[model samples]
Target: MIRFENVSVTYDGAYEPAVQDIDFTVPEGELTLLVGPSGTGKSTVLGAVSGLVPHFTGGTLRGRVTVAGRDTRTHKPRELADVVGTVGQDPLSHFVTDTVEDELAYGMESLGLAPDVMRRRVEETLDLLGLNELRDRPIATLSGGQQQRVAIGSVLTPHPKVLVLDEPTSALDPAAAEEVLAVLQRLVHDLGTTVLMAEHRLERVVHYADRVVLLPSSGARPVLGTPPEVMAVSPVYPPVVDLGRLAGWSPLPLTIRDARRSAGELRERLADIAPVNGRLPHGDTSPRKDPNPRPEVPAPRRFLRRRTTRTAPDTSTPHPAAAVTALAVHRDRVEALRHVELTVTPGETVALMGRNGAGKSTLLAALVGLVEPTRGSVRVGGAVPHRAAPRDLVQRVGLVPQEPRDLLYADTVAAECAAADRDAGAAEGSCRALVSELLPGVGDDTHPRDLSEGQRLALALAVVLTARPPLLLLDEPTRGLDYAAKARLVSILRALAAEGHAIVLATHDVELAAEIAHRVVVLADGEVVADGPTADVVVASPSFAPQVTKVLAPQRWLTVSQVREALSS
Candidate 1:
């Protein structure tokens, strides 16, 4: 249904093509997954399928891209709307209506479909995506994950023959992601719909793909094969495949069930050697305690004083980096968070996890002073966040929000890094160094807006770390990052925590939590449903466990790194 013949794309800039000599064919009624590292033109390839590459994006296409026998070169996106539906990474940019129901119906209305048909399709999409309760909610009031579902449903309602998605499940929780993927599976199997998706979170979608197309690196030719064939040689793969490689299993397993079937002997090998706890090593930082400590301050003071004036190296009796007691926040008459209590000490990492709109992002907002608590108190670095002065707050805490572009205002990346250094009172090139470390090959002259989603996230993170705040907050830190980039990020964050910085990240990436988080705090319906050690919280819950933990069940293993450590010792 989709064919690319010697395709190459180059923007107006003076450089080589973004994608070079990309040729592939995706059969009708099959799901094709596009895999690659950041900035390898996965998005560009998807845009070509929808005719957005050279048409709306102001790029030059050298070859042919056809969808459903319609040449994209001749057919613009609007002309092909009847047969093609495209959903990009940023869902907020795709909406034209105010509410969920309206957004879903907007596409059909544009297509001039009958009102009755449109209504029926809209209801079906809402139920398929589990957006029934949110159908009346405003798009602005919904969470990031909810917005992603609405974006997908808007495209799905049109009943197009082809669906082109970019990071479709990046923002969704595990269960929601599975629901969306299952719906795509039904479309492929029952309705003969075609799907071409590009995603960074391979663990969630690799096994669901009918075929795999890999763009190994920038300007490299594409490699197409079955999932196992491609994953055997592909640079990026999920943890289950990684375990299969480590155990020397033939035909690397793509799913947990396959891995578990071959794990009987491996389980016995690890039975005597307990899996290493995936936490900060003891003696690396301060003495640890339960994350849910009793409240030390009774009232919220505008200018609360620091508990101790000693430096970061002074770990004896160190105060909490951030404290929340009976915290509550209400937005648009909805209780976003209610009576949430938590504490984070210096040199600690915590992950806030839950379903879409379950108060994880809201809690992070309260910590960084973006949202005022309806009740209770929030203290970060010994000062009330909402009332603290801007200058003081910069030194106390820094937040990398869900939308990375929100933190970038400069025209070029170089200018943004310079501005961050000056604002943070840091030496020149500090931000640039962090950027290079996190995401290599990002040029100084490039526009921040032109960077890929993962690249933008890295720039935002570097800007925040330039200030060296005692407390750091990240929302969906690994949204666009591949395994290599995520590993660099884990190394950086671990080093920061060792230097006495407290980290709290709100994310749905269970593999990431399993890798770096010392604690996992699960939220539900604006309340704290569960909070405990990473291994304890994720392993016990079927919804949040990583691939390795699920494969090696009855054993408390959480990550491939832990298993590798145990095997090496």
Candidate 2:
């Protein structure tokens, strides 16, 4: 059990306290969820519990904090190592070993556990994490998801009573994230270990949480309650929750299975009303009211979206593929993207999804000539990447990287847009208009990276669109976004596809793939394992399936909106 008695934390930096006069208690063996928008002190609370608050982080802590009845102020992280285990947003920051096996054993060795005990725990944890196959693999070779599991396994080997995770699944692909989450669930359900986790992707994990703690950013204090109690009152929720609100169902269903049943009842009761057509007319239910002094924690949402200017293209005609061919790439070692055949006509959105290090980034780089493949050829607009100068590719192919900081460093957003246009020989006036349309919040003089990650991605996208690139390659475009930001980003991507721009969105979000992508290409170990429509690809990989699939139309649905539609229909 972890208890905070009037605990407030203030950092040395200028400004207000990170956490103010907070009082809360997490009972032992309960799965508690800590949720709030970015910079909301969720991580601060975790640090307090882990003995890093005033110790490692050098923060001022008022009042008392105790774990399992032991005062935390007296115990530093190293001192409390036997009681609590913690993981952070980025795994690379905490890794202390060179290989997966060595990584797992490092923590136990710190505790001075006997060799036999350590070996048994190591073997058990590796098997439990489904990482036995990668036991000897170098930590650097593992995907983001795999590395995170190894991190978790390392901590669990010591058998701490409390586990704290800060967005453990944020960087992972949907399938691998689910695998890691399942282990966490098992730990809580089977072992009764206390789990406190803060995450942005609530839709993926909210349904499974035993308790919900919502922290409003305006220092409005937190509200702790059950999942349904919190979600029913949540100002911003996922599509299913949104449906429950708009449809006015009592005891709102957090899962689609329950939503489906309630929806059927509503349909029967409202049979006399205008026959339901999945989507209501121009206006459905009134928008949610946010007159409260503090806004409820809106669901983890996106930063922003970019747009391209041009009368939206009409994608009514599907272009026939000239032919499917193999693209070979050689980079020191042969990372074969075997017979990588893809079929995309104008107007199709194809999503490339896989765990980190699965070659999604490599594939994107290959198409643009940043990396040359020894075996296959990349033909864009019926020409090769090097076939044109960087300027020519700017006019024909657009690429947005995962880290928005990668290409943006200009003094102003307008300058960045103008630079891309000048290189592509596009009209400066046209570029400015396109940038404004794509990023409404940003001004001409705004620093590109100064905006949020979502905004930067949108800005980069706008700059690329300004070039009128026929083929657009976006790598993990939604990497650090929340629910609303991701929704808007996909909306923009969808609109672009509707306008006939050939788009390849490389992402780890299965929900996004289900919602926007016409097709999904699954890459594993640097090779395409499945390529087809979103529905087909989801069917082929059950773990990669989105939550909506398990909820409404267990087999056919991929996105939450689709699940809601099927339920009402």
Query: Per-residue lDDT for 254-278 in model 1, tens only?
Result: 9999999999999999888765442
How big is the positional error of residue 253 in model 2, measured in Å on the Cα after superposition? 2.8
lDDT of 2 by residue, 207-317 (tens): 778998877778877878998888876544666676577668778777767877876654454334221112111112354221111111122123122333444433444
- How displaced is residue 471 in candidate 2, in Å? 3.2
What TM-score would each prediction reach against the true structure? 0.94, 0.76
Off by over 4 Å in 2: 7-21, 51-64, 69-76, 256-324, 329-336, 354-359, 386-395, 403-469, 498-500, 524-529, 535-545, 554-569
Q: Which candidate should be chosen as best, given TM-score against the real structure?
A: 1
